[model samples]
Target: MYISILCFGIFSCQDLNLEPKGMLGGPELFGNEYGVKKYFAAIYNALPIEDFLYYGTNSNNAYRPDNYWEAGKNSLGNMSGEFFNTWVQVDNDGFAYWPYDRIRDINVFIQSFPEYQVNYTAEVYNNLLGEAHFLRAFFYFGLAKRYGGVPIIKEAQDPLAPVETLEVPRNSEYDTWKFIYEDLTFAMENMSTDIDETGRANKYVAAALLSRTMLYAGSIAKYSQYLGFQGEAATSAGMAGIDASKADEFFQYCVDAGKVVETGPYALYTRGYPDKAKNFADLFLDAESSESIFIKSYDITAPGNNRLRHSYDALMCPQPDMSSFVGAESYPPLDFMELYDMPAIVNPDGTPVRFDHRGDIRNGMEPRARGTMYFDGDVLRGKAFDIQRGIYKNFDVLASDADQGSPNAPINNPNNRILGGRGWTTEINGTTLNITGAHGNFEDQGGENNGWGSAFIRKYVDPDRATSDVREYRSDQHWVVFRLGEIYLNTAEALYELGSRDEAFNYIEKIRERAGATITRPALDQSTSNIGTINKANYPYSIEKSLQFIRDERARELYGENHWWWDLRRWRTADQVLNQFRHRVLSSYYVADEGKYIYLDEINRINRSWTASKQCYYEPIPWGEIGKNRNLLPQNPLY
Candidate 1:
C-alpha cells in the first residue's frame, strides 16, 4: 500500500519526495512556529523600502524627486537606467515587485502559521499575530499610497495556478485604507506597548504609521480646496485626489498616536559629551540612543552591506583641503538653505529687519559654509602646492583667484582662505574658537569660490565606512524608519489641516522646544483660516508660509534622513520648490563660470535632470502585474 501510494504520488504530484508536504511544500517549511517567527523578522526588515536620499534626493541639496538624478546633472543622470527609470517615480510597473515580494511572504506565513501546533501565552501570541498583521497593513498602505487600486491578497496561492483567482481586481483606495486602519488597530491592541529595541515597531510606531497613512489619504480626498493655485498641479489630475477637509479626521489620528508615544517611554536625544561641538551630529553616529525609535543597524565589520556614511562623506567632504572633500559639487541650493534661515525680525512698529547673516552654525548665527569648510594660512602656506592635483585642481588659485582676489601677493590674497585655525571659526560660550582641518577632516575646506557651498547632507555617514575622501558606499548608521520627532510633525500638520491651528501650534512648538528653537505665537491665531467653512482672507502665502516654514524646520531637523521629497510631493508644490532650486543652482554655476572656469557638463546635467511631467506625478502600473490581475487595476494617468 505504501509502495502504491508512492507510485501514485509520482504520477499525481510533480515531485514525490516533496509531495504531501502540503501543496508545493509551503506548509511543510512554514508550518513550524519557529519558521513563522523568522519569516516575520524578514517582513520587519523591509518596512522602509528605500534609502531615497543618497542615490537621488540630495543631488543638488534640493529635491530631485526621481532616480538617475544627481545634484548638478541635467538628464536625471541616466548613467544606469534602472535607478533613473524605475526608482524615480511611482510607476505601477516597478510597484508590483517589492510590495508584493513582502506581501507574498506575509501571506504565506499567515496561511502556514495556523496549522502549527505551538503553545503560546496570550500576550506573546497576540503580539506575534499582531506584528504580522501590522506588516501586511504597512506594505498595503505603502502600495495603496503609490498605486491606488492594488490586488488585496491575504492567503498563500499555488504558483502554477492561473493568477486569475490570485489576480483579484484592484480594491478602492478607501477600501485599502480601511484594511490598513483595521490592521494597525489590531497591532495597537495586540502588540507590546514597549519594545526592547528602538528598531522594532511598538504600539506607538504603529500608531504613527496609521496617522501618516490617513494623512496621505485625507489629503488626496481633499485637493479641491487649492485648485486655484497656479502651477502644473493646479488641475485636479495633478493631485492624487486629496481633500483639505480630511485634515481634521486624519490629524486627530496623529494626535491620538502622539499621545500614545508621548505617554509611553520614548525621549528625544538630548545628551552630549565633553566635546560640545560634536553633540548635535552625534546622535546619528551612535547606535544606542534612547530617541532612535527604529534603526537599521550596521556592522562595519560586515562584508557587502554598509549604511549612509559613505554618501555623507562623499557629499559633505570638501576638496583639496585634506578635509575629506572629494567633489564639493552637490551643496544645498539657496532655496532649501533659506528655509532654515530665521524669519525677518519685526519691530513693534511693524518694520521688518533682516537678521544678520551670521551664517549657518551648530549653535549660533554663522554661515554653514564657514564651519563646514576651511581655506586658510595653514592650508595654503604649508600645504597649498603640496595638495594641488588634478582632482584637487589649483587649490590656491581657485581660492585666491576669485573675481576680487589676487594670484600674486597683492590685494585679495588667497592666504585669507587658509583654514588652519584661521579659515573658519565656531562660536562656543560667546567665544569664536577656531577649528583646524588636519589630514582628512570634514571641516576646514574652502567655501563657495573654492568649490564649497552652504549645501550639506548630514543624515547618514559612518567614519568606519571608507578610508579615502570619496565615500561612495552605504553607511552603517541605522535608518530611523519612524522617529519620535516625526510623530510630533505629523500631529502638527494634521492639527493645522483640521482647523485646530492653536492645537497644531502646540504640537509644532513641542518639536521646536525639543530642537531648542524659540517660538512666537500668532497674535490672532489663524488656524481656522484653511478649513473649508472659514471666509477668511487667504492672507497671501499664510497657508503656504506656515506650511513651508514647518516643512523647512522638518528638513533642517531631519536633513539627510530622507523625507523631504515625499513631503514636498504631499504638499503639492514639488514642481515649484524643485524648479526654484534648479534655476538658482544653475545660475550660480553659470555666474561662477563667466569669470573663468567652466563645468558645462555639470550645468547641462542639472538643467535637464528631472521634470514634473504627468508621468512623474503618478507612477505607471507594471505591465506584468496588469496581465496577472486584469479585473481590479488600471495604469495611472500619464504613466
Candidate 2:
C-alpha cells in the first residue's frame, strides 16, 4: 500500500499536517504502539548531545563552502587548553543555542499525549508519556543552563495566539531549576526502570541528569554571587543570578540524586582486556560495557543513514589510515600532562617522583595518562606511534638547542612538513636516509598537518575502525553520556560541598583504584588518605585542597572527553584555569632514544577575556527571539 506517513520529526516548528492516503491522525497514531514509537524517534533525534555524528560550526560560508571541521573537538579542547587545535577562533560564536521551536514540539507532544485514544497496553502508553515529560524537562534544562531563567512554558500554546498572550517573561533562576527538578522527579517516578533499546532513557538516565543539573544549580547559588555584576536586569527579573540562600538545599538534591545512581547497577569498568592503559583506552570502545549509564549509540550499517557518519576519525585520529585521511592536527600540552600523577616515583605522602636526572618526562607517570596521550615508543593495540618530531643528528648526540633559540631558528626541517611529499632530510655520501611517515602528520600532496603539541591524542580512537580501505568510516564507539565513574565524582563533589569532607575522600578512592593508583579504596581513609601518588601533589586534609585534586582528577580522567570546561565554569574557576593556558609548553621525548628529551616551549594556546562578568555564566539569547517578543529582555543581563 502506497501510504503517506505524516509523523512527528525534528523541525524548528510544530506541524500537524498529514497526507490523505491511509492518513494517521492523533487518535490513530498514538493508539498504535508502532505509530507512537516512530513519533518519539524524531524527538530523540533532536537531542543536543555532541555525539559521533554532530559536526558543529564550519567557516563563514565562504571559500570552504562545506567545511564541517570546527566544533566536534578542536574548539572544545582548545577552550579547556588540554590540546591545541590548528583551527583557532578567538571571539567566535560563544554557545549560540536557542531552540524554542523544538521546545514547543516537546510541549505539543506532552499536551496532546493524554487525549490520544490508545488501544495499546497501559505500560506502553505510560512509557511514552514518561518520555515526553523527561524530554521536555531535558530540553528546558539545556535552555536554562545556556540562557538562565528562560520562560517556563509547560503546555503547548496556539500558533495563532495573540503576541501579547504569548510573551511570557523569564522565570527566576531558582524557580527554573525547581521546574526542571519537578519534571525530572515525575519522570523518575513514572519512567520504566529498563529500556529495550541501548540509547533509550530510563530512570537511571533521569537520575544521572538530575544529579548533574542539581550540582550546577548548587554551584550557581553558592559561588555566582561573589563574581557577577549586579544591575537592573539582574534585580528586575532573575536573569543571570541564582538565590544564594538555596545553595545547601540544591546541594542535598545533588547528593540524593547521585546516591540513587550509586545504588543502581552502574560501576567503574574494572574487568577488561590487557593492562591499565589498554583498559582505559578500550572503556570508550566497548559499547556493551556496564560503566555507561546512558549512551548515544550510532549505527553505520543503517542504509540511507550512512550520511550520519562523522569526520571525527579524520580530525582527531592522528595516524594516516585513522584520520579518514584529513585534518590530522591538534596535540596535548605540558600544563595538561602535569595533572597526571606518577604512582611509581611519587609516594602516597605527597612526595615528588624521583627523576633519574634532569628532564625525564616519562619515568614515573599514570598509565592512564600514557593511555590517554602518546609518549615515546608508546604502542596502542598493535600499532606503534612513532612521534619523532624532534630529530637528532646522531645516536649518541642530543641537540644542544631543543628550544626555539631564535624566532627565526626555523621549525626543524620545514621540508618534512608535507609528510611523504618531501623525502629524506640529510644524506651521508651519495645515498639518502629517509626518516618518513610521522605519526602526527598526514599529507595528500599539498594538504599536510604536523602535530603542534609533542604527543598525539590516543583516548577515543578505535583501532579496529581505522580501516585502510574505508577512511571515511565514522567510528561507532558509543559516547558515555553519564557513566558510573562520573557519578562517583559527582557524589564526592556534592558531599565535599555539604561538609562531609571525610566521606568525599572515600568516594574519590574508587575512581583512583580504577585508574590503577598505588592506593586502593580499601587503603584510603581520613587517616591514610594522605596518598598523593594518585593526586597532583600532597592531598591536604582541607576541603579546598581536596577540591583542587578533584578538579585535577576530572581533567586526567576526562581529558579528551571534555566536561572539564563546564566543570570549571560551574566552580567559578574559568578565568583562573583558562587564563593560565595563554602559554602552553610541550615536551617531546625521542622514540629512538628514550633518555633524550626535548622541549617545544612558547606555545600560547588559550583565548579568553579575564573580565569577571557573571553574564559569562549564561549565553546570550538570540536577538531574533527578542525582536519578535518584547519579554525575553533585558536579554540575559549583559547581552
Candidate 3:
C-alpha cells in the first residue's frame, strides 16, 4: 500500500491520531507470526523511501544547481522552501519516523511472539531476532548520519504520553556511531547469512552499511584532523569532519568487511546471460545477474514499475523540432568527467586504463568530445553527452518557450517556460557544438526566460525506455549498494593510504580484470606504448598518484549509479570539480573579437560567487529541526 505522507509529521502534534496505536497491540496481530512478518516487511518497505538512496541531490529536479528548495519544482510545499534555509526543522517525510516506528513494531513483535508457541522453533526465532538487531542498527545508522546524536528509542511510545517527557537529549556523534557498530556486530553474529528475498537486510547488506559507515567516519576524521571544528568549512558535508588518522581506520574497516564477501558465497556478479550481451554492462543492466547482493525488488504485479525509469523519461524526454532527446537536468559537470583520463587510442574495453599524460586525459574526455558520448553513431556507454531535446513542441514545455522566443517571428503561446526545450553546447570530436535545449533562449508562457542548467545528464536514463515524454517507464531498477568491485576499490584505496603501492595495484588490477578493461602494468620493455617507453613525466609513479588514479577509475566505472557525488565530496573535489566545469563550459561558449572564448575571463571578473560559496560545504541542517529541538540540533555553519 502507498504509505501516507502524513506519517512524516506524525511527531509534530502530541495528540495526533495518525499513530499506529492498535495495529501492533491488537489481538489480531499480537498473537501471530504472520502479523510479525508482515509488520517486518513494512519496515523493510520503509527503507527505500527516504532512509537510504533518497536521491538527495536537489540539482536533479529543475535543471538548477539546487532545485529541491524551489517551490515550483517540488510538491513538499513550504518544506521545499526550508530546503534552502538551514533553520528549517522538517524531517524526511518518509524516514524521520521509521526507526522509531519499526523499533516499536519490533518490540511488540518480540513481546507477543510467545503467542505462537505452537509454531516456535529455534531457526524461526533466531532469524526474527537477527533481523530485528540488523534493522535496529540500520535505523540508528541513519540517525547518526543525519544528526550528530539522536535518542536511541528502543521501545514503542505511549500515545497518551507527554511530548516533553518523551523528548530525549542528543547523543554524541561518536557515541551514536559506536552504538550502531556494536548493534550491527550483534546482528551479524545472530543473523543467518541467507535471505530469500531481495530487499530484506542480510548479513552482507549489514556489512555494506558498515563499510560505508566506516568509510564516512574514517574519511571525516582524516580530513578534519587539522581544522578546529567551527562553522561550515567546505562545499560538501564529506569534507567537514575529515581526519587523516580517522580516514585510515575507516578504510581499514571497509576493507575488513569486504573480505568476508570476497572469500564467501558472495562473488562479483560477473556471469551474464550468454543468450543476451555477454558484456559486464549486461551484468549491471540485467536484473538476473548473481553479483547483485541486495536489490530493491519491484514487481509489476505488486508495487511494480521502476520510479527511476519514469523519472528519467519525465526529465529527459525530448521536445519536438529539437532533434535531441529531453530535459537534461543534473548534467555531469565537466570537472567530474575530467577525472577519467582518456585513453590515447579509444579501447572498447570497459575498464578505464591509465593515461600517458594527465593533461591529455583531460582533453580527450571532455563532454564536448565525441570520445565522451557519440562514438561513430552508436550510444557508447562510456561517453557522456548534453541533454537531448526533440524538435516537437507537444512533448516538452521548455521547447515551446524556445519556439515562441525565436526572433523568426509568430511567437507561439509558451505553456510552462521552465518545462522543456533547448540543449547545452558540448564538444563532439574536439569541435564545439551547440546542443541547444529548453535552457537556451526558451521563453515561458509568462514571457519570462525559462530554463535551468545548460548541461543534461543522461546516465540514469534507460536507453530501452526512451519515449516521447522521457518518463515513459518508471524503472523500478535495483540500485547496487555494495558489490565485489567496490570492495576491491576500497581495499586498493586503503592499501594505498597505508603506503602499500604494490599491494594496492594488485587490488586495482583485480577490478580492471573484472571490468574486462585494459590494465596498465609497470614497464618491462621499451615498447613506446608500453610503460617502459613512456616518459616519467607522462605517468604517475607514487603511492599518492596510485590512490588518485584508482579513485578516478571508480568514478568512471560507477558514474551514474549514485557513488561519484559522495566520492567527490570525500576527495574534497566537489567545488573543484563543479566550479571548474562550469568555468570551462562558460569560457568555451563566449567568443571574443579574435574568436577566442572569453566566458572564463568574464565569469572570473564578475564575482567569484561559485568559488566563494565552496566554503558552504555540507548542506545546512533543516532549520525547523533546530527550532524544535534546539538542545539537540546544531547548524552546519554558513547555510
- Candidates ranked by lDDT, best first? 2, 1, 3
Q: What is the lDDT of residue 185 in candidate 3?
A: 65
Query: lDDT value for candidate 2?
Result: 0.60
Cα lDDT of model 2 by residue, 95-200, tens digit = 4566566667667667767776346467766777777778877777777776768889987676578988898877888888888898888888777888457888
Q: What is candidate 3's lDDT per residue for 229-296, written digit by digit as tens?
A: 44443313322353344556667776776665565466555564231113455555556656666666
Taking every candidate in turn, the Cα RMSD to the unseen true structure, in Å, is 10.5, 6.4, 11.7
> What's the lDDT for candidate 3?
0.43
Better of 1 and 3 by TM-score: 1
Task: Highest lDDT: give the candidate number.
Answer: 2
**Candidate 3, after superposition: displacement of residue 29 in Å?**
4.3
Report how far off residue 295 is in candidate 3 (Å). Answer: 1.2
Q: How badly does each model clash, as a count of residue pairs?
A: 63, 2, 77
Per TM-score, the best of the predicted structures is 2
Alpha-carbon local distance difference test for all models: 0.46, 0.60, 0.43
| Model 2 TM-score relative to the real fold | 0.81
The TM-score, computed over Cα atoms with residue i paired to residue i, of candidate 1 is: 0.67
Q: Which digits, one per residue and each the tens of the lDDT, describe model 1 over residues 1-639?
A: 222233234334544444555333433334454655555565665564444333332232222123321322211221111111112422112323335666766665555455553655667667767777888888887676656545667775666777556667666555566678788888889888877755666777777778777766665555424434323222233223434545456556656766777776767666664332234455666666666666655443465432223343444444434234343333443333333442332334442222222121222322222222221221221233111101111223332233311133332243333223224444434745333322211223332213322233333433343335344333345656766777777777767667666777776676655554556444424342332111111222235446535555566565545465555445544444443122122111111112221111012112323334223434555667666566634455544
